[model samples]
Target: MSIAGVLILPQVIQRGDPGEVVHFFGIPIVLASYTSSVIPMIVVVWVQGHVERWLKRTLAASIENFTTPFLILLILPSATLMTIGPVTMAFSAGISGGVEWIFEASPWVAGAVMGGLWQVFVMFGLHWGLIPIMINDVATLGYSVMKAPVVASVIAQGAAALAVFFRLRRDHKIKQAALPSGIASLLAGITEPAVYGVNLPLKRPFIIACLSGAVGGAVTASGGSAADNLANPSLLSISAYLNHGNFVVFCLGVLISFLLAFFGTLFFGIPRSAREEEQPQELSEDLDSGIPAQPVPADKKVVDADAQVVPAGVVVPVAVDEGNTTDLVAAASGHAVPLSEIEDPVFSSGAMGQGLGIRPATGADGSSDAESPTGAHPGRIVAPISGKLTAAMNSGHAYGVRADTGVEVLVHVGIDTVQLDGREFTPHVTKGDTVTAGQVLVDVDLPTVTEAGYDPTVITIITNSDHFSTIEPRTGIDLAAGDLTVVVER
Candidate 1:
């Protein structure tokens, strides 16, 4: 049908007049115009499938074969041309006309709106509404303008994923997932994985991709590009626009969409915290490798009065010290407040251990003292004691350090900040790294954290308070990094 429509049907239509009749074997056969039509052939084929099945079931074998061929060749085609074809064509025409009217009224606005909202529709599974309309437009008018801008939405999503892949080169786990998803979207136009799995989780990159898609959609609409076939927008489907004069403009719009989304996400979308959280799980998997296999000699082992000696069967060595007080310093430059004053119950009730919450000090420039010179918030988190980091969340929101004095401290950045998945924190060191007092542990963007609706109070807790005779927290005092905030006696 496609070949006949494109090659032979036009000439036949030009040679004949409407309502013309032809004869076969002295029998009159009225020719209802079907040249270059889309629905008639499809309806006939659809009807034939059902009709053949019925004929085979009801008729005997020898009779069924002969009757089925006659019924399909003569009756089905006539019924399709008389009923189904004309009705479907009219319906398709109405849809095409309505869409054309909208495009004609304001091409640029229509393009931008559609391009921006296409992904939103996809996210909610509402884009299915446009699929049939796009198909009808191609069937009735030989092209569809609606899909041209939608193509930008697909391309932009892929670009956002590619941007993250490039930005998070050190994050092996994230790179492993993102690289394949991005390539699939770019070459094959599959975008749901990139959108749902990668871009949406990061927030900013998804918005940037939408904005870039809007730009491409507007450009394509302004240049009057339309897809000539009902096919997905991809490099492989470029041939669908070959005969259309707007092919070059279509290609250019796609390129602009890709470049804009890729660069926009790379520069401003993904945060340091998100990138830092992409560390491979392998670091935490080899637990045995980090443990000491043998115990130290009795002469070298100094047990603290508070230390309990478990049988030597435990995999990891426990630190010990004589009865002495260890001062735990503040992790951030801020004024300390008692944990009871904090808004969250987990900290206020001392459920996450005994701690003091600090409200970060604001600088003269209206930025928090914890903010970096580059204007990123929660400037830095420093080690409060010279210790080995026993556990650190890849999200950079929390760290557990065990001092040689047998004091275990947990530096937690904020209340419920874990839900942000490390969008505003950057870790300077991973778990198992030896850190000294005042050494940078993580850099945080407090403004972004607050903007995400999380409290930016830094909490310093004596996690293993049971190992100490007394854990005293100092509150209502202005303190800097390394200043004594908690006193632990063992």
Candidate 2:
């Protein structure tokens, strides 16, 4: 249908009315003028999925094969022409008219509003509402101006992620995570990973990206650019703009948005404190010695507390004795809660492993502190046990630490936070890095978690429970970071 509309239909229309009726097998068939449209085809195809299932259930195998094809090829198309086709066409026309009115009223204002709020809509899942309008615009008007500005928003997000990746160049773990996410957004028009993982956590980059996207959107709208199809707005989909004369303007808009966001974030998005905190440390000649020098085996003898200093202001109450019990500290200060009270099934059921959940404390007024520029609920996930960081999610929502004595702990922040990607979390240490008791693992934004409709309860579990003789929990108590929360006995 698309090929015929673009190639053969124009010639056919030049000769005679494309909608003229013709007799076939003594039956009148009214030829559709807008046969190349998208909505009617989509509606027909959607109805076909349901129709095929009903046909299979009602017909016998011997007769079904022949009858099904007849119904699908003849009856279905006729029914679509008589019913679904006209209805969808009318619907598309209405939506196109409405959007055209909005754009015609004030192009630049419309562009700025749409581009700036597009990502916000995505965060709350409201962007799905715009999909139909975009599809309708192409079907009714043969092109859509709405999506041209959206391309700017998508590219800006990717540029912001790249800026963060460069800013944290020394942190291999963060670089590993940010680079791929950035590329995905820039090339594929998928911005969730970049928005939630890299930009939102930092705050400044996300704001700058939105502003830059607005500028690009205004420029594209002022140039009267429109996309020829409903394809996602990404670099790879630039071909959609070729049908219109504004391809160059679209390309220029995308470039401007990307560069503006990249430079804006690189200069001002990352905080000075974060830079100071993440500065590279001098490495010893023998890298194998590791941070907080490897402890002597329990069989060798007990290690003194003074000799083993905790990192990042974490306090270890007991001396290191490998054969003896190990204390797992509370990663954040909060009201202690039972795992059963958590909203998520995986954590509440204790199926992920035996653990305790903490409902993190908010501001002094018991309200969220998310309005602060740095974010609300400023707290760090401290190292629960003196061990090597074995696994850490790039999303910053989860971490796995393995003690020298073989006790493995999984500290997961927020129930279902993985959905947010990495919006409100920041990792201080990467996987495989040796960490001491009280070392800051990740910093979390609790208010952002709550505002996103997720429970801000952090769960700490002993993943390798079989190796321990007993796993004890300090429940029903308000605890601070590095406070004894669990005891793992080998």
Candidate 3:
């Protein structure tokens, strides 16, 4: 109805001069065009969703399906035309014009701020506010200068990823993921891979990329580079700039963005842990691969000369009950499972060390017996080893214990349970507290965790498993608090 020749609505006809008019029952109509506008549509859809929800809740069940549609179809469209359309259009246009004015008046500040905060805008959905303006600029002016800065932002993300790849030494998995996301960002205009996987996870790299993007955006805008057509910003789409924009300056902008981000990340972005070399990867994989290394018979001498960290310890009877060997007890009773079954890659991939997962057992009333009145909350997690409580979150979801033997253990209660804000957790100890084996750390309420849509599995991880000679986990069985479960031989 808004476009010159699309759907011909009733009573909405082309009158004299000032365009189309809706002459309905002598009512004064505001003929606001909804032609390729984004804000008005977004506002309309949002209002529709809220109205539908309210109607669904207020209507009687017998008449809900039929009567709800009747009311929506009857009342919403007319109300929208009279209310939301004009207001949203004016609001959107004002903001768009104001931003354009600011940018035109101060190109350097505009370029720097827009380039640096583009990723932040995407994160919080503020980027949607600019979509209509960019589209309108293309539709009305045949080009858009606003998008030049954004293209540099994408280039910076890829550059940061590539820098992380080159800087990383220990984790081959991160390197493999980093290289691909970087390439994808440089070739195509996809930033999700680099943004989520590489740069954002490695905090400093993201900041460096943003700063580099700001520099590049300033150069691109000030040097008079613009896009002739609205194309996805990438190296493959650079041809679009060749027609009318300064293609040479555009190349220079991207090159500067890439070099700055790449070098900045290489110099200051990588963390010390990522660069530190670790034990062979295969040793950790053997724990969860379901193919155990051939165990030597009780009497035969087991040889582990080729093992990277320490000798594989699966000897018999006496268990060599001596030196450097540390025993880890179960934090709570549950059905034990292998770490490979866990959803979080940090623990599942053994990146945080050898992990053991235990699904909490539920009692009669959907809650764990740990919450029972007996005061003997068996579901409560205890310190696995007598060590200093090094890390205890205020949220009471996880705890870290560092033993004198140099073994570090992290006791995590449930996956993503932190979102509950300690709703089902009770912390018994704080950070820097010296705890004994079997001492209660955090009492868990399994039912609340389950009801809140999180996995209530307690996990115990050996943080520095590579430093030890062998880490042996006993899974696929029932566990009890204080029961010896993991054996780490140094």
Candidate 4:
């Protein structure tokens, strides 16, 4: 799709008026514009995938790479320009026209339906059909009723997140995540974080917000409000969209959506299990006990899972044997937690791949001041799986290990502890080092890090998380310095 999109985009006709699109082969071949389209590209890509696979199997290997791309580029552009592109564009335009018809019949009903399910449409790639309608409405009628209800849905989600923020205590990590995610949606009109991280997780908030959005959309459309511009549905961009008649109605509807979702979540409350889960709790007793992190003496021996007593200095082979699943161990001895509790959006949002957080902190203050019980120093961060140290930061705050099975793992000690300038961190390994699971990679002075005002949660992430079918973080349970914490499947 990457290579094909670039090749096909430049040649797609920009002709909007029916008369301007001259017929191909003297037949009325409608060349629909592909600006901001989804369905067409999806269709093309689907076809291209099959086409590329067939090409690879049939073509001679000597010319396979060159011929495959060459053939795909040649076949897709013409098929798209003539058939698939026109048909999908027509289908999208047809959906748009049908929506316009509904608005014409009863704007209120149209608004209610679109507003309630706009997010669903966005999720399923079905909303691409509406883009042309909105563009056409603005150009021909100077306003787009189809565009009016969008903000209602957006605002509702934002309001729900805001409600979650208010519902959780100040010390709760979800509360912290909800606040920024809500602001991003309510102000900036970006709701992916809010929807995925906050609202959807709670379940009820999402349903409530959608219903509230319906009411808001109904009000906006019933009052004959329309959008004159195509822009993100956000508070900052609302002014540009409110130029049509009954603009006050649009604002009023938006306000209603916000208030409704907010109140609905507040009054209804989240699940009992959620409430209980949100309560402040400490990690395992092993971590709470003030055990110092200690390195094994060269003469000492640690027994492997296979029961082989290997000497401390003899680096065990980086473990890479696997089948359907790859299990990662706890790199830090503390309370195992979901990435969502890590206080870092990059980790919590599942954007950096699925992983877990080991909170060494005794309380919800999010400082990992505790290491573990074994009387061994808790500051030691070990390799969870046997892998080559692909990235060993000199600062000793982060390490990226690549398992021979092609799994990339990142072990980051503490949140924002890098600001401490490596003053309290000691690196035991460097880049390109092969390490066994349970081998100490870095030893940090947890107390010094916590006193320096940094979170001491040890974060472990699979950098290539998306490559697998599923990456499950088995958290919220007791784990030792090297216990199974995450499971990734292919």
| Whole-model lDDT, model 3 | 0.79
lDDT of 3 by residue, 190-270 (tens): 988999998998899999999999998887776556676778888898887675556787788888999999999998989
Instruction: Enumerate clash totals for all models, in the order shown.
Output: 5, 1, 1, 9
Residue range with the least summed lDDT across 10 consecutive positions in model 4? 362-371
Error of 2 at 282 (Å): 12
Tens digits of lDDT, candidate 2, 1-490: 3322332355434432456665546776555555445666667778877887899899999999889767776566556655565577677787788788877787777777777788988999888878777876776578888887898899999999998888864445655677888999989999989998888877998999999999888777766778888777888998888876467877888899999999999899887665544547888998767657667886788758797666864545656565778788777777767778888898778777777887777553443322222232335667788888999999998889988878888988887889988887878889999998778888877776787788878889888777777887877877777767887777
Residues 1-490 of candidate 4: C-alpha lDDT, one tens digit per residue: 6534642454443453342455665766555556556567778888999999999999999999889988988778777777887687677667667766788789889899988998788877788866756876665456678877888999999999988887755437677789899999989989889888888777888899899989999988887777778888888888765567588888899999999999998767476455544546756678736677679889987767787678864435444446767878889878889998889888899888889998764343323434444433567788988889989877899999998778899999988877777877889899999999888998888877877788888999998887899887777775667767787778
The digit string of per-residue lDDT tens for model 1 on 282-360 reads 5556787877688779678766867965665333423535458887778887778999999988778887678798888
Candidate ordering by TM-score (highest first): 3, 2, 4, 1
Candidate 1 C-alpha error for residue 300, in Å: 21
CA RMSD of each candidate after superposition: 23.4, 20.5, 14.4, 18.7
Whichever of 1 and 2 has more TM-score, that candidate is: 2
Q: Model 2 reaches what TM-score against the true structure?
A: 0.48
Q: Distance from true position, residue 386, model 4, in Å?
A: 28
Q: Over the full model, what C-alpha lDDT does candidate 2 score relative to the true structure? A: 0.77
Model 1 lDDT, full chain set: 0.77
